[model samples]
Target: MSATAPTETQDLAPVRTESLAELLIATERPPRPSALSACLTFGWRAMLKIKHVPEQLFDVTAFPIMMVLMYTYLFGGALAGSPQEYIQYLLPGILVMSVVMITMYTGVSVNTDIEKGVFDRFRTLPIWRPSTMVGYLLGDALRYAIASVVILTVGLIMGFRPDGGLLGVVGGIAVLLVFSFAFSWIWTMFGLLLRTEKSVMGVSMMVIFPLTFLSDIFVKPETMPGWLQAFVNNNPITHVSSAVRALMDGTSPTTELMWTLGWVVLLVGVFGPVTMRLYNRK
Candidate 1:
């Protein structure tokens, strides 16, 4: 009888199911990160993006300087009789405008990450759910602080003085940051809801321009028409700007600050859950 050739299966070793199980069990799974730890980690990741692309800082630095200079000179003589005098009024409001305007980029960043599928990996992770969103805000909070400092520096060079002194300036910036952090939730929600980065930007501009310009950023709300003033008086930007201005002027901004904090609560309350829902679904 002719010897039969050994089949491929006959040469193979028996499968080691027990060995595989033992190997997997050998290494203990790492514990899950706390919410704060996860958020801080993602926040650091955002900072790393800035480190890789230093140009990311242009909005906070160069744009703020330009705003301080342009508005100080352009409307200074006409509005306040001189650039120096106008900077006194314009700096605080402009700081608010610059920072708030830049908050849109948070949404842009979120959208870009989504488009590139970065968030898909994030979603697969076992960390806290809202950490990613909170991380974006925390990173952008640094941008907001930088913008505030840049604007303040430019204003100082241009003869803008804060009557509130160091304490006042610090308080003003602190309040601005709080409001900005809260305000950013709106954009985060938009970022999750919108399909494209450009769409997110367009909608943000539409909403921000009306809120920033129609309020007291550039001109006194009282100068506007009665109907417009009605809206401006109620605008959240108005409260924030007024609060900052009052703080810098070394006065108690109780009413404005209360209104601003209320808006902060209202904004986060309304948009925070909606954003999380979208993030989960997305």
Candidate 2:
């Protein structure tokens, strides 16, 4: 009988099996740690920029300090009790405002990246897909944290004391930072959607100005007319400001924190997806 035809494997006998080392080397790369690594790298870069520039820290730190002193020394008696008492009352609100202002840096940063074509380069890199947007937000959170600390330190120097103790102060700052992160997402969307940094600042000012004025920032919401009062009462900033005040005053848990967090969840849920979408388009 004729010998059976060689099997397919025998026909391909010249092929060499890969060594374990080669196999491991050629193995598919591990899944991208897009969010984590990107956040870390981008955040580290932000810190580095802050360290190098030094001047950028001025807006976040000095501006808030000046605002506190101006309000306390100039308008303190007109608005409330003595400057010391006003400092006590206003520091928390000012801190919240400081964090809110700090969030604008997110847009400024994005604009800078766009101008420098940094984001374009990012597209060429095999980075974690989620890192682009997550990295930005993470970087901003770090910046905001630093600004908040500096602002709080200045407030302390100016005789503003938080009666809630060290833990309370920590919690107060934490609350404001979380609120700022949530707020930053909204601005991030605006920044991404806009073509210029100045436009981002202008539009943001228009959007936030009314909200800030109507909230309990410079005055008690209850002191306003009914319509304004209703709006102020419903504003998320009002709740955040009130919650921060309560925390600074060493008061018990209030509905304001709960409300503020609820809004934070809602905004993050909405804008988190928006950021991902816009980031992908870029």
Candidate 3:
């Protein structure tokens, strides 16, 4: 008789389920990272993206420089009687404007990550819920700092002197960074809600342009019509710009600073939770 084909049980070796379970459970799981640690880790990851793509710095560096040059030359004489004199007022405001404008990119970046499915992986990680969002703001804070330094350097070279000296400059920049960090949360919310990066950017520009241009960044609200002045004076950007300008000018910035800080608190308070909600749902 022909040899019987090997039985089905003989054809396949048995799987060692016990050994497989042992292999899987052999090592103890490490403790999860703390919230602060997780946030900083993700923040470092954001910085690494910049490191790999150095061109990302163009907005922080080149854009600020261009704003300094263009405004100082273009509006200096007409607005303040001379380029040098104009920069005395323009530099601080321009710094605020430039930094605030770039804040929108945080949203763009978040949207890009979402589109690339990076956020799906991020959500799976055992980290603090808000760490990723905070990380993006922290990374953008560095970008704000870079833009501040760049603008200040260009301003100084162009004869813009700060009466408040080094301390004042540092203080002003610190305030701007704080506000910018808070402001970025709004965009982060948009990033989660918007379907595309371009939509996020477009909406950001629409909001930012009116705010920057309408505020005291380029001119005194006093020069505008009463209706316009009312809006400008109440504008959050006006408060921030005035605070920064005062700090740089060695003048008391108490009222303006208080307003700026209040707005910062409001922005963070409102947008922070909304962004988290969207983030969790998305």
Q: For residues 45-88, write the lDDT of model 2, one tens digit per residue.
A: 87788789988788877787787788788867887867877788
lDDT of 1 at 136: 95
List, residue by residue over 43-129, the lDDT tens digit for candidate 1: 999889999999999999999898888888889999989888888888899989999999999999999999999999999999999
Backbone clash pairs for candidate 2 read: none
Better of 1 and 2 by TM-score: 1
Ranking by TM-score: 3, 1, 2
> Residue 267 CA error for candidate 3 (Å)?
0.7
Best by lDDT: 3
Overall local distance difference test of candidate 3: 0.94
Question: Which ten contiguous residues of candidate 2 have the minimum total lDDT?
Answer: 9-18
* Per-model TM against the reference: 0.93, 0.85, 0.93
Clashes of each: 0, 0, 0
**Steric clash pairs (candidate 1):** none
Question: Tens digits of per-residue lDDT for model 3 on 137-219?
Answer: 89888889999999999999999899999999999999999999999999999999999999999999999999999999988
